[model samples]
Target: MNKLPPDPAPATRLDRSQRSGPTIRDVARAAGVSIGTVSKALNNAGTLKQETRERVAEAARALGFRPNDLAQALHRGQSFTVGLISNDSFGRFTMPILEGLESVLHDERIAVFMCNATDDPEREREHLEQLMGKRVDGLVFTARRADRRPSVGVNLGDLPTVFVFSQSDDPRSFCLLPDDEGGAYLGARHLVATGGRRIAHVTGPERFEAVRLRRDGYRRALAEAGLDWRDDFFLPGEWSEQWGRQAVDILFSSTAAAPDSILAGNDQIARGILDALRDRGLNVPGQVGVVGFDNWGVMVEAARPRLTSIDMNLSTLGQEAGRRILRMIGGEHFSGVERLPCTLMVRESCGAQAKTLFQEARST
Candidate 1:
């Protein structure tokens, strides 16, 4: 009897895969529809009645059905994936950009392959090659600085490439950047409207293109307000808190009429200016109004008097870049540089009653 029971146990040839879990067929059966209709409803492809789509979705949920992404990619002949390569080591910029970009991508069930080049040319080249080999639908390159950098070193014709917060000399490239020049103009104008005369510009090195552009903006604002753009009033130094403090010391120690206000290069420097002013018994917004660029929340919020600064709208930029790349993937042609305008995040440090002043300035 035991020998007969053992003989009866010979296994069926059907593999375990066919025996386990819910598949599209299971959903179709549960929803009382064809497998093709289930697929169409789930993938949002081809028109279908709203009730039918809802029924299929309910069936999938109840059965715990998950369509295999690999199978779908194969059927569609597209990986539904993209590559994002960046050299921003200090995640201050890249993290938010990814957050914004991925929000758009997740809706379409697309995936991202992120690569950090670490500011090495060889490493960047290898990443580019690897992404291309993976047959990605599109590529995005980003960096901390707004300066021009070398292209990916390979001619990728019509591959839906996008560059953000950085640029290339290639005339045909689609580039996205912040309008730093206009931002600086806005900051300086705010100081003027706040009643700052003999204003000093304390900023980063002149070698940076951003610094130069901001300088032009400062000059233009001063010119418009009929204030003198004096050479000594322009203080160029490293973009650091220490430099901000040092510039303040140098300005106060001088025999020339001390600046009634200062426009710092970045948030860090602005915080330092505030700290130095505290040490020297100077009042902000009353004795000296202060404004900064790069309304970085970490520094601005933590500062003694929260900083009033320029907002680069980086998240908006990232979202727009994602939308543009999606359109590019759909065969849209875009070329040349696109500069997005920056906004002023008015706060306590600007020496005016924050609410009414911000409203008034925005109205103009």
Candidate 2:
């Protein structure tokens, strides 16, 4: 067989024309003022007289010259661009969110410079420095952990930052997390309403805020139904299909017996569970009901049983993050945190009798 060549490298969105627009010196010449006076006026320095500031401003406007963001950063030590950093897996989850944010930021004409950290602190540090050099206005990071405090390169105090799809213990930075409590509550409610009791939970690593929140949501649901929460009924593992398989072992080994329904932390985990169950001659929704978080349409549709899951609304998540950053840039203030909603998607995995079977189950 003949071998195929590798794909071409992706083109960079950044270009010289985008970065190297009109210059401050050009503005100063057009304004007919000393470069220092123009700089002072643009920086809003009190050293310049009020009339002088007006003249400089008028000159800049006439010449169609805007302040060079790079030059302005060198003087005032702040960039207008915001630094966005995330890992590959997080990048996948954040794509829709970015789309949402872009919809808003594109209107504001503010640029978002992104970096892939690959979960490496060293790489993160390197990217952080690069963004600082670019004089980014603020930052938005999606990873749960940072190798070093952002202050190592950029001034976090003067610059605004917001975290999305992750949590930070820092009180100063704003955070937005998925509504795990709500998702869990809804998952349990769905199962119960559909005649599911003896529920099982396949969860992600406890270290992740999203994972923990989903687990709590499941627990709350179980409690609301007046059912005892069983630790043995829980399958704890990584966020992968393999972990879902591992969860199955833990589920069957439990003394209380395997559950009729399951709340998987995410779709990938749920997929593993579905496949493993089939290997054991189990019919999903008939022998076992399954629900997953992060409703990846392609994956869910392609699955044999077509897994039922929750939509974390990542696009909405991104949109909100974009809005927050724009608000900060535009001098609007937002406080505390915002939590987005999750939607429950029904499919065969939940074992809800087919809508056609609904009448049959009810008649029975």
Q: Candidate 1, which segments miss by more than 4 Å at Cα?
A: 1-71, 357-364
- Candidate 2 residue lDDT tens string, 107-161: 8666788888886778878998888778687777775331123423344565667
CA lDDT of each candidate? 0.85, 0.74
Task: Kindly report which residue stretches of model 2 are placed more than 4 angstroms away from their true locations once superposed.
Answer: 1-80, 144-154, 253-256, 353-364
- Give the Cα error of residue 224 in candidate 2, in Å: 1.5
Clashes of each: 0, 5
Q: Write the per-residue lDDT of candidate 1 for residues 244-289, one digit (tens) a residue.
A: 9998998899898999988888888888899999899998877888
Quote model 1's TM-score.
0.81
Model 1 misses residue 16 by how many Å? 14
Candidate 2 accuracy as TM-score = 0.73
Cα displacement (angstroms), candidate 2, residue 197, comes to 0.9
